[model samples]
Target: MTGHQKTAFVTGASTGFGAAIARRFAADGARVVAAARRIDKLAALAEEFGPTVLPLQLDVRDRAAVAAAVDGLPAEFADVDVLVNNAGLAKGLSPAQQADLDDWDQMVDTNCKGLVYCARALLPGMVARGRGHVINLGSIAANYPYPGGNVYGATKAFVRQFSLNLRADLHGTGVRVTCVEPGLAGGTEFSVVRFQGDQDKADAVYSGVQPLTADDVAESVHWAAAQPAHVNINIIELTPVAQSFAPLRVHRDTD
Candidate 1:
């Protein structure tokens, strides 16, 4: 889909969708700069892909660090034609009143503020060059709220709106923005993290059901970025065939 090669930067590239997307981009002849907090994992990915991938350790939640990483990009991977804002996480799944405040803060920091920092740092170059793609990872929770998805869902909604606003702001700049929202994705540490390392609990989230995989999400990102220069895919929402909207909850009282 990429013609004549391009430089792509993917955050949270240590595993899951981010890593998959980075690999796919490299296979398609794009130079990839993979960023994640896990240097070992990122190094493994870089080694696996040989010279096409450049691994850089980063935590998206750190604004100064994120800026430093981008500013320090090696010459070969300096011109990032595509930026995948994929470094996000979900915390405790308790109801709002019972939810952990730390969890809520973490979600907001990483998903909303972290995204803004990356976009702020990279957008000037994209807009000035008049060519770029920023693909933000969102969630189905942004579209349909579920109990326990409180802060996580809210953060994704911020991402969705942010993408739309970016489009308006970049009207004639030839820079593109998109929000990819996925539901019921498996083969990732998302649930494990959310459940605080309870493997069994994490496993149950996708048990007895077929769900989307990281590769599926990666493919969607690749497809959107692969579109013609004149084409812009605003938002793409995806879910596994086995998943659908749930009926609204209602409480009954007997006299």
Candidate 2:
């Protein structure tokens, strides 16, 4: 979606993978509509990229706001060729029994509902135009669940299935859907948000581990989007060499 003048709308563009993806497309000459809740960070992005980047303050969790944002885009950016649903988070790391209900609600709202809202809003336009790509940010947790990954992982699993179902629905519509799942990514506000602003706890998640960087994830997204129109990438799951599968947990009762 780059190397020329294509419009790419990216959510959660305030920082991390979203920001990196926005920059990646903009640097390649694509018009980028960088949307996020933090206007200041978006402003910084627009300032850096100048006219190529249109910074729009957006909270994807708000369905009405998403509809309005999409319908209200300026003439130049209204025709979004690519929609990157990158606005999502993990609220808490506690196990299910001890988890906060509010955290679970938030995870579902942002990671699941918000994503569906964005896709629903943009898909029609893509179909009308006969060409578009929806790049969703999923997680390895969707397939490989960890103890504390309850709601977060479930929401991503929803994302995975939803992407596949979308393909089934859009078979010959000329639109494509791809889910990019990453494991143990670092250098993002993801952990900080999950830990509820506890910097120390967030830092510990990547300590002594060369986790996947935001750029790595962005590059994967870029590659998927840049593929020829004939090729539709179903899913791209990746992780750092330092990260891989773990042995199944075994529990034994002690008498």
Candidate 3:
């Protein structure tokens, strides 16, 4: 509220949507706290954006560590005006029957639990200050389920509901919440992570047509966050023009 340039805390910021969002915030004159599990990738923040970028090595799945990081934010970056919950991933495109339990657990922990942990740690401050925005990165899978979208889609569904619920609970608190859902995003580690390092499989997801880039999603985050203090953008669902939904699957017996 004082002389502090709007401070934004961004998770999963080492690459992809996280990094792109961090860059956008910094470009718009906001002091950005970029947190991720990869410290080496985070170093690129200082190289690219100089001192305004506070790189913090974080794994949101670790509740204790997440709490410690938020509680220990430096005096300069303590007053967070915006929180971008972007640390999420989808593992393996196999059907539920063939899915790995470990993959399901990891996705649940990171996509759902990790998000809650960060929000629980930071929302109190936002409510106390009576001015803050929480922007969550959801996915279209939340609405339109596919064969292999199982746990990943469920996690995003949680995000969608959580954002709406937060808005409801913070009715008179001057706080805003938004969920940005993207589909078929390209040029990021998402597919790579999802495919478990299979570059060929990852590339195949976007081989035929161009898909939304991390910057595009970042732009959406920026636009929502840049709204007037009195305005709140609820949910922004985006996908490339080349993408769309298909009819429900119905298998008929050939007997």
The sequence of per-residue lDDT tens digits that candidate 1 reaches over residues 158-189 is 99999999999999999999999999999999
Rank order (by lDDT, best first): 3, 2, 1
List, residue by residue over 125-199, the lDDT tens digit for candidate 2: 999999999999999999998989999999999999999999999999999999999999999999999999999
Off by over 4 Å in 1: 1-3
Candidate 3 lDDT over residue span 1-255, tens digit each: 235579999999999999999999998889999999997998878688888899999999999999999999998888899999999999998999999999999999999999999999999999999999999999999999998999999999999999999999999999999999999999899989998999998888888889999999999999998888999999999999999989999999999
> Could you tell me the C-alpha RMSD of candidate 3 in Å?
1.5
lDDT of 3 at 153: 98
lDDT of 2: 0.94
The estimated TM-scores of all candidates read 0.98, 0.98, 0.98
Which ten-residue region of model 2 has the weakest summed lDDT?
1-10
Q: Score each candidate by Cα lDDT.
A: 0.93, 0.94, 0.94
User: What's the lDDT for residue 174 in model 2?
Assistant: 99
Q: Which ten residues in a row have the lowest lDDT in candidate 1?
A: 1-10
The C-alpha local distance difference test score for the whole of candidate 3 amounts to 0.94
Query: Which regions of candidate 3 fall more than 4 Å away from where they truly are?
Result: 1-4
**How does residue 10 of candidate 3 score in lDDT?**
98
